[model samples]
Target chain A: MIVDSNLSFLQYCSNDELKTLCDTLTHDNKGEVRLSEQLTDNDVYLRCYPDNMKGMWQEIAAELQRFGGNTFANIFRGGVGASYESILRDVCKKMKVRIPSCSTVEEIEIALLTKYCEETIGSMDIDLLHELSVEIGIKPQSYNKQIVAAAILVALRRGGGKVLAPVIYYIGSNISRILIGRGVYLATAGVLGRAAAALAGPIGWALTAGWLAFDIASPAYRVTVPAVIQVACMRLKHNSHFLTAQCV
Target chain B: MHPADAKAILALKKIPGFNYLVRKYMEYGGESLYRGQNLANHVKVYEDNFPALYRVFKETVTALGIDEPELYVYNDPYINAYTYGETRTFIAISSGAVETLSPDELKGVLAHECGHIVCHHTFYNTLLYSLVELADSFKGIPYMLFGPLVLALQYWSRRSELSADRCATSIVGAQAYQKVLAKLASGMKSFKPNGKELLNQAYEYHDIIEGSLWGKIQQNCQVAFQSHPQLCERAYEVDRWSKSCRYRQSRIRVC
Candidate 1:
């Protein structure tokens, strides 16, 4: 498989578009499959490839035209049948979901698709989401999963490169504090904490401000952490659409 | 060795003429020149002279089961320590470090430097030192010629410190190692730094760098020439490792 240098193009694509692209690439024509020369796992490619790639080419072309020339180069460069299971697994891993052992590919796909809606999203309280919405400068009209996901999507997209870092940082700090519990907090009670406390009311604000203050080292975590959060938010948005459609 | 350190070293070795460049530097009075400068400028610690400091060095070497390297103390206000020279290596601690760190923390520092010796890190580390000096001196041809090489070395150098930190933890326990790191983080400026808080600060920095693409890019460019990982990063790594099964196993074996 030819790995594209510009994997960022994948970031621009939606879940449906990615599925469409995957189907087009892996579609078997007259039983002559284009096996990836690089990957040794023939069985993975065989079982995983979408069966109707020959029929999907026109649709993919139309989609690529919409994305323009840069995405055109990216799509062709990424022209190999990647396992849909693997893609789902990557997203699940980024979302920090611990899948049960010995699960089948179908099970994994179901797990990823329903993961946010069935588990964490259902469990999340409206007040927490409301607070998060307010923190990101969004005032939600109703306290629902749909509104929360929309608010997060807007904030994440609007913040983009300039304000995205602090926004993510703030969300992460609050989430961690929630997960771990504030009373159990033993790390941030010193001079730095005191100084940051002087800045504002919410500790997440202080955490974000403190994070922005320092210059740091280059670790792969720099990419992974934000990517994980972004993936979670994007998945939340996708799942909320499903919820809305189900209600309708 | 840390996985990152091993990976970086492999990548660094793949660079053309890198091995040859390191060999040439050693062959052409590079190590000797630095050794001479050390002997001339720094005060050597021994039984006859700085017996108290020498004891800590001896204890660390004994714990790690390596022959004692020369120990030197330089009159620098910066709380710093470094290990250099391959054939006859020496660990140099700044006077500020001697004053700042406690006796146990000082042992942790020594163990870290000795960790480099035990892991056969001195050879490549000496090359890193020389390249840094060369970068400072020549600045044009050498910098352009070995820019990527130096960056790779620095990358390896940062990971190498983590391995050293683990070694130090094995000898002195994780708490002492973390405290030593926190003390180092203070740079002799503050009274006493809370290790947990300092680690939280590191986590915050980690979040910031991870949070934004621009932040990561800015850091990558800035740290391309740095020989060490940031103090908070070191603290974070050691602390995280301390909770690992490997750290527990090493502690048991060392004990």
Candidate 2:
């Protein structure tokens, strides 16, 4: 059985399972198998199939998975060797999302997130829920009376802040400006949040507030805020011992 | 070299001052001028930087029994691949073409450019480039006097592309070759196209060309000065040749 190490398969497989599969592949091929590096989320996974053994891929996957676990179940997630389009379709179906016909990968992701939110928002805290709704740039309380509102925020984040703003603006016409403004606001908040966490003191909070005020005052300053905050946070982190010693 | 190249050469020979112009350009610093510009603008393809693509190029040259031409990749958004220089022929593929095409499709493009080298299009192409440079310098004198020469050269240039298309088809099958044309026609963004549908459209274009005199005239006028044939026409030619006995006999199993 030929062992394939596609993304969906690698995502589920434990390190031990991956090692075993790699060992089996190497042994079967007498060390011809090449494992370049561990697959990362950002990496585009190209399907690997053994040469001249085309039709027997299913049997190979089954046999390999038997040695491993449901790590191989992902190979059968759509079928023996599913196309990315099919996998996206399957995910959409399970989420009960109706994506526009022939939507790109980014659009499908947003749709799935929107559906998930609609199905499960009743249990969320009111203030946290309000923050989430603002983060996604939608009046979750008014527009989406169903479960759709919950998923939108997470979906927007996943789809990318820049991309989701236009999408949200398009969907919620009356609140378009608010949605775009909120997207920018949320993105800045998230960046500042990171800077604050990294700096870790009253001084960090003061610096974050200063940076936020400066960012709000000038659009040009907003571009540099993230970089400036990152550098400032790094410098503070590096000088933590010196500051602590001075205080003592 | 392919059979169609011989026909193109015959057509080129019939054009007045074609050989004289080519010889004159060769005598001038035409080769150095282009080589110097290319050296400045492009990065040479080598095993270290582009191992897999270099392997494909080397294998293709060996299979075709042509001297290995220097290959370079230039950063340009325009999806184009072309060959230049007379004594030292070089093939240059745009970064856009490399990024946009699949490995097999890229190989087909490289093979097509190499085909120009194999079929001796580089010499005439160099001559044409020299004439254009001269026209730029003199500002209308050369163009006015050698207008017909330019037209004839352009005509042969289009025919040369068809010959190169056949050469590419022989190396990487017709499907891959047709995809190069299809991708060039349709930019690398937006909807993915059906290959069979693209091929059928090319065939359908042939009917359009045959059915109306105006369509034929319009198509001819449109590509009158262009170096390459329209994508659909090239696609149709490649598809037709793939099924031909000549292609079957000459086909190399690279994949």
Candidate 3:
């Protein structure tokens, strides 16, 4: 099928614009069918179950008893479809509705998405994964230098490896304080070259782009210019030499 | 390789945080980021003030068989404009500048911007800015060396302005340009003076352009370290070139 627009399945759709989209992508076009954007195997059992972690864990435990499925790898290893990561705490807390202290990353994920989801999970979406990760309080921005530096100090106390880049300890603090906005943040001008080197791919793009938008050097003509100029200069020299000889 | 494809590849290798999106984009081909809702959602507010200008921009594109160019605004004071090169081009004019000039002047500025697209300048800039973001990333380099490189980029940037100026002049001929310049001379030059005397001042501007040796020196003095040639200089340059032996023979129809 021809790709009609930039948005994937929901690119053009609203939360309620389901009627407008064709059901060719659906395994069952009937209104009875639904797909969770999570990973699930038992589509039928998935439909009736609550989506919390407790419900998920109950489903997982029941499935284990039913099919002898009893390994951490067996459940968590399958797919990245479940929004289990987003509501991990909610899932565990929801499981608390049944039993207490049943909490772990793997259990929370598998319980919610693998067994608890009401419909088969749709394809994996990285954005949803990131959002889920955020929900679990795994803030990515806090992973910059100072946090690493503090970790290093703790590491040094426990006798870890030598500090590879100690200067960054002082610099990252300053960078965190100042570096704002999306453009190049001069966290550490000292390591800027290194950062720039790291950023070579993007910078190279900017250079090439800046060059093209700003510099219009025709390679075809670059090759031709010197060749043509050299020939023309040679003829001019020859004529000048002849004129000098005639004058003499 | 085509510049567009080549830059896309380069952008993938570079632009660190954007790699994930860029790679996914390559795997599943990305399409133009336009939708019909773009008009009523964004374009409607612009219609409130300049209703006629807004109508012409929206309806004329479909009527004239040209795709509607995407528009964006960024706040900057110094006067500058550019066009984006993509599946179709998009153009934007800053409000800081709009507040500075008139309707005719804005149209002339946009026509000059359109000239860049017509001349295919944006394709190169898209590549160049991508590289600039790359070069800009390399912060540890000695300023002694890197400083000159950036300055040179900027220096060349100033030269490219001259090239676009030619395109601007061509699209909006000397007649329209003369009116625009007069309006600018009155508004921009903080002075209160004679009326007919200023129109005759074009002769003085012309003299500064194609003048005696002293006049040439004065003209150079006026434009030194200036990225754009002054309005008088632009008028003079166009006037001189159009009157020259070679420009008359050009088939592109510039007067």
DockQ winner, 1 or 3: 1
Relative to the unseen true structure, what is the C-alpha lDDT of residue A45 in candidate 3, on a scale of 0 to 100? 25
Sort all candidates by TM-score, best to worst. 1, 2, 3
The clash count for each model shown is 2, 6, 42
| Candidate that would win on DockQ | 1
Candidate 2, which segments miss by more than 4 Å at Cα? A1-248, B1-5, B133-142, B189-192, B252-255
- Candidate 2 docks with a DockQ of 0.01
Per-prediction DockQ comes to 0.01, 0.01, 0.01
Ten-residue region with minimum lDDT total, candidate 3 chain B = B1-10
Candidate 1 TM-score over all chains jointly: 0.51
Worst 10 residues of 2 chain A by lDDT: A37-46
Per-residue lDDT of A98-136 in model 3, one digit per residue for the tens?
A: 223545433333332222111111111333323322433
Candidate with the larger TM-score of 1 and 2: 1
lDDT of 1 at B114: 88
Off by over 4 Å in 3: A1-248, B1-50, B55-68, B73-80, B85-88, B126-152, B181-227, B241-255
